[model samples]
Target chain A: MSKEWIGKTSNKVKNTVDRLLVKRFAESIGDLHPIFVDETYGEKSKYGVNIAPPTFPRVFDYGVLEGVDLPMKGLIHGEETYQYERPLLVGEEVYCYTIIQDYYERKGKSGDMGFVVIKRVGEDAKGNIIFTEIQNVIITEAVRKGINV
Target chain B: MKTMTEFKPGETLKVTLAPVSRLDLIKYAGASGDFNPIHTIDEEAKKAGLPGIIAHGMWTMGNLGKLFTPFLEKGFIKEYKVRFAGMVFLDDVLTLKAELAETSGNDLFFNVKAVKEKGQEVVKGSVHFRLYDAV
Candidate 1:
């Protein structure tokens, strides 16, 4: 595989947070926190409205992968990290962009493998970043065989 | 686990998560747009040489996030990171074992890890958070 994806960035994608989206995400993870799903509970909370789960931003569209095409079939999610400025609020709009932060190769028990690190940053309309998520993806040779030519 | 204000170093907060089911995986796939066959498709997972359908890494992470939701509601979590140490299969009972590593003024740092009933480590990470003093 070519190491040409380093530093590549995607176009900005817009996403809106709402009660249904927030509730569904919380339910999906079986986290039925009242702050996320109960309207009355949220109305009295400090955030003034229902809030999204901490990982709700994962559902945000970070545009398309502009670079680093790989056979995703065998891809492995190696790790993930998130830094938050504040908990995301329901009914807020956030714009996000994805970037290929780094790429490297190493030998593993399965043979040679490549690791790609991608980052996505979400910001409010005023351009203040609300949160950033970094994910590490591993691609193995066996998985590469499934890639379409 | 007691309130964050009373948290002490060497103290541990233990939480047993609900068993992760195939339906949960499907719901997560629909909500998160992950849709990875390794997470939702049994035959595709077998073809990939996996034991069976595995839960999405973020699903485990989100479960971990639940542990701190209370703290987040009262205080604030500045950062959270995790390394996917092992796979979580269907019907796995995950336990979150978190220990406070240190405390500096209002900042509390802790090391958190998740494991199955059989003691297989699934996720390991650390969290840094700040507590708000009541007025």
Candidate 2:
């Protein structure tokens, strides 16, 4: 068990909330909401700037934590949650990093399963917290065995 | 736009998504930076022990947020949560539903979910949002 990772935090990754990045994410989800795509609409809206969709941060990369042995191929995204201080504004620089919140194992029909809880945090240039996303990743017994963890 | 007072608790909203395709998944991979092969190439999916390529769980969850797009001006989504109940495969048509769960002051709480054509829930959760006036 990679219990040592429970308190590990990854290095921060900087992301510019660019317009095109927001637009592409909106399009991929089939949501063409003007607030996310139309700059003019965004300019006139309450936000005064285009905002990324609520789930947009899923795209941001949180730099890797060294020595983590989990395999990426078979891990399942079991659950997700996002807590926002406010919507991410377009063009604002966001620095994000991930922390391993917890880890536990359970028995399942197929085999033993390990659940990893990770919290990814984003902050503004001043380092004020912007949003926090907590996601649960599941590793099946086979994948764990392959890694010999 | 429906004002916070105008929306009654238990009011439900629904959005039916077009069947998901491989092209859509490919585009999502490019946009979201999650290029895990199980969500794209069939061969890679097979190697991962899946029957075939499956859609990214984020793709489906992202679409579920669409149920509240119309309310963006009223308020932004302060919180969105979901549990991935099952895998979403290519060409699977999904239906998203959200029912107003409660209202307090400017905050609106909703119970949301995503279901496939066969009525299987692929994702289900809740959304918490507050009105702009309350900000």
Give TM-scores for every candidate, taking all chains together and pairing residue i with residue i. Answer: 0.94, 0.96
Runs in model 1 deviating more than 4 A are A145-149
Interface RMSD of each: 1.1, 0.8
How does candidate 2 score on lDDT? 0.91
* Candidate 2 wrongly placed segments (more than 4 Å): none
Q: What does the i-RMS of model 2 come to?
A: 0.8
Model 1: number of backbone collisions: 0
C-alpha DockQ of every model: 0.77, 0.86
Error of 1 at A37 (Å): 1.4
Over A1-149, each residue of candidate 2 has an lDDT whose tens digit, in order, gives: 58888999999999889889899999999998898899899999988998888899988888898877878778989999999999999999999999999988899998999899999999998999999999999999989899877
Residue B74 lDDT (model 1): 71
Per-model CA lDDT versus the true structure: 0.85, 0.91
